[model samples]
Target chain A: MAEDCILETSGLVKEFRGFVAVNDVNLKVRRGHIHALIGPNGAGKTTCFNLLTKFLEPTRGQIRFNGIDITREAPQKIARRGIVRSFQISAVFPHLTVLENVRIALQRKLGTSFHFWKSDRGLNQLNDRAMELLTAVDLAGYADMVTVEMPYGRKRALEIATTLALDPELMLLDEPTQGMGHEDVHRVMELIKQVSANRTILMVEHNMKVVAGISDTLTVLARGSVLAEGPYAEVAANPLVIEAYMGTEASGLASIPANDDRPPGPLPGEGDDHGSLRSNSGGAG
Target chain B: MSRRVTIAYLLGLALLLAAPMFIYPILVMKVLCFALFACAFNLLLGYTGLLSFGHAVFLGGAAYVTGHALKVWELPTLVGLLAGTVAAAALGWVIGSLAIRRQGIYFAMVTLALAQMVYFLFLQAPFTGGEDGLQGVPRGTLFGLDLSVDINLYYLVLAIFAGSFWLIQRTIHSPFGQILKAIRENEPRAISLGYDVAKYKLLAFVLSAGLAGLAGATKTVVFKFATLTDAHWHTSGEVVLMTLLGGMGTVFGPVVGATVIVTLQNELADKVGSLVTVIMGAIFVICVLAFRRGIVGESLALYRRMIGQKAG
Candidate 1:
């Protein structure tokens, strides 16, 4: 019950048919911190994120944003409540330009108006703000470009700026650095860090190194349940994690050193717990 | 706006305004009515990415309603117009609710099925006069003056066309219109964004249908008849063809498309009465393949790109 906890999910559960995708998950995201959720895979990280954002309703649970119950609110309503996300896939309007895409998001944030009789270009505040977000993401140079023509990576970056246009108090990044080369990953990581300076950030990432490099606190999920949760150092050295990691990837992966420079240990449980849950389901289902 | 576009719009407006003097006023009125019809249809197909084969329901339904009001009840022109618009909106509400149940091509089938039902209703309804329809209806004065003359009727039609066009333009630029676009682009995402996507879509459909009724209302008086042709599935097809030819989402695209189809029908009606159908089909194909954005959409896209490059 931290005074400044920005987000909290209590007993969150999402079940499909007879199987549970996310099971009785309890988590907290503090203010001005980059909280990373990581697991090997199928750790229910995505399902948890979906429930938190109200993109998917939980079968049973409570999602509170700054002490407000938002468990069953619509995604846009939740987004308007100051939580916004960038999807794993680029979700921009292909027909509109990069600037227009950002502008649409800005327009949504502004109150609805019946008077569109006048020119739409006079909203200098929105344009200036969108331009700022584009610059922050290092995409100011491509503002005028039609979204469809932009390269894949730039499109992804623009998606982040679009989400930013909603003026989120808590930003949800679903694999922000995914599908990138090392250099691009580094640049995005820098952008995320800069953004996290003001707003709270919660991310579900597969990259263990990036997770460790950014997260202030971490939660590890396995089979829709918490396997471990805490600061990066303590969880990395846990023996249960090593055992879990080794049994995954069909290759029984290499050992993560107990004292390795493994980028600060993204969240406590990291990928080990996620690997175990999905693999076990393969036999059960 | 680019100088060419500004000049072209002005020139087109001038030509349309002077149409009654050069062309038979009745022919000019026909073009304007159909143009408005095409623009109304575009609200759904182009702006909302909905292909409604049921739009003839609005056009024809309005005609029948206006026909009854003007001929049977002898109501004034305003009353007839209101009757048509209200009937269209009612039909739009029911059909939009049902048609929106499916998406993509399936939605098209649903609307087409619904429209066929409406066509049958019009065929059997007592007010429709079956095959004969309502004939020799008066154009009526604005309030008390007789607009029975060709010049007065032409001006009336032109004013309706201009008002409907301006209203539609305003609708597209509104917040609600933006939500519809969001639905068109990605329904699931729009749903996730918290807007009741279906409600927004339904409203657009109803409004489009109602405005289309206004066009149909004026058309009945312009031709001095209300007939089965107004409700024909061919009418639906023709409207769709015009929208596709003009580009789905552009403001003036439907107007230009309507004018082209109307002019084509006039000139080509002599050599081959039905050959205009073939020509319209060909134009639709050419527009779809070569200029998928339509004349206005492509031009706007180009303008946007050019400005984007300049900004860049």
Candidate 2:
């Protein structure tokens, strides 16, 4: 069972000054599974992602990847160890062409990323592979286009393509479909599903459809701790998870599919609770 | 390179070769030295997105080292230049290691503070000759060519400048350069892609510093002296102004910027005296206000727009 888990965290805690952002999270992501980490606005999903990637040091805890402790490793070292993460915001190099963005990721494998004396013409060798990755994300036509001029949804797709170029054993995606139209969201979900073959993906997602449609396993967090962990269907029906998502009086667990596209409306006596959730997410941004 | 750009470069080189015939060779040499220095500064500022406020440390520090080697150690000109370049690169490594820990304005402050320390060390150091400056340094022979002659020395400076310029161009377009652009565009993204961002930044700082040192050493050979003015904060500020005036990121922008500023100072010194400072300041203000993309950057943008319209 231990060998089956690709990434595991035990007693992982993160605090900002005196305030605890993540408190004693114990997580296990099984190998080759599409694991989704989902919660309400202030549930510390982003903070957990930061700790897993070592962008923020945990106040107390241990993180293991393939049975080796990686709690103290640098972000780049973790990435080199096959944990590549995408950003909540689109992370493409704005001035570079779409092809160049993917090529940069592939260039690391050539071991010439530090060779300043050599002509970049050698990097032309990477163009075919870069184009292949772009083609995977349906960005082959936009290869020559500067990334900043790309539409918002296309930029997210580019980010995914760039991430895929790394060919990581485990890919962590933060809010991959945060802001998108229905068409783009569906396209990206399909892209994610297509790319998940033979690779493990751990994603922090807000869209319930994206979470419910693709995730093989789900972990629900509330107030920096795991409230429920199971299949999406099972976690959705957990009474405590329902209360954490709505209030105690809420009986709308079955309507989760319908309410997934929009924020759940303010239930009676839950007005202040909903308002605070909105404000917390806004402030985090 | 584009056909248009290659042609422009060839034409520019021809003009430079013919320049000494009409303009004073020493003045043109001075411009070349400063132009190279500005270009080195631009590598860190424009391409890598590091605004080093203490670049004059490398420039002036190398000048002093080259001058000392030639006058006191009696080393060959090439050796003296190499020694100076290596010293400045070492300094850059130290400074960059510390400065890259911070970002934006804080990074600038760290470089500035360290440069001030080096300035004071040079000011009081016995080898630098203090306020008297390192004077009467010989232009030692290179390949048995007597560089004492201005024309011989001018050609040497031009060769050095052209080589360094080519190196910078190659670096800006190399695999390393692509990483640098990626780092500049999005540092965190670069890191998440498994790049040790600090290492790249430090390497860039060292390269930029070494090139600046080469420029300084060449200037010392041309003028036969090294002065306190080279290491001063004002000189550091001047390089920033030159880079901004010409175009911060574009190739050839700093060269044009350095030429204009150096020529203006040379031309105005006799007529305006200290008011040249005020006039330069005014030009800087106007540049920041109206020509933020700078002379070369703006022209390139306009050219692209015209080409785009034609294609459309």
Q: What is the TM-score of chain B alone in each candidate?
A: 0.92, 0.98
Give candidate 1's fnat, 2 decimals: 0.27
Q: Top lDDT: which candidate number?
A: 2
lDDT by residue for model 1 over A55-158, one digit each (tens)?
A: 78799989999999988887778877888877766677776678877777777656562333434434445788889889888889998988889877787788
DockQ of all predictions against the true structure, Cα-based: 0.31, 0.85
Worst 10 residues of 2 chain B by lDDT: B1-10
Among incorrect, acceptable, medium and high, the docking class of model 1 is acceptable
Best DockQ goes to which candidate? 2
Report the Cα lDDT for residue A11, model 1. 90
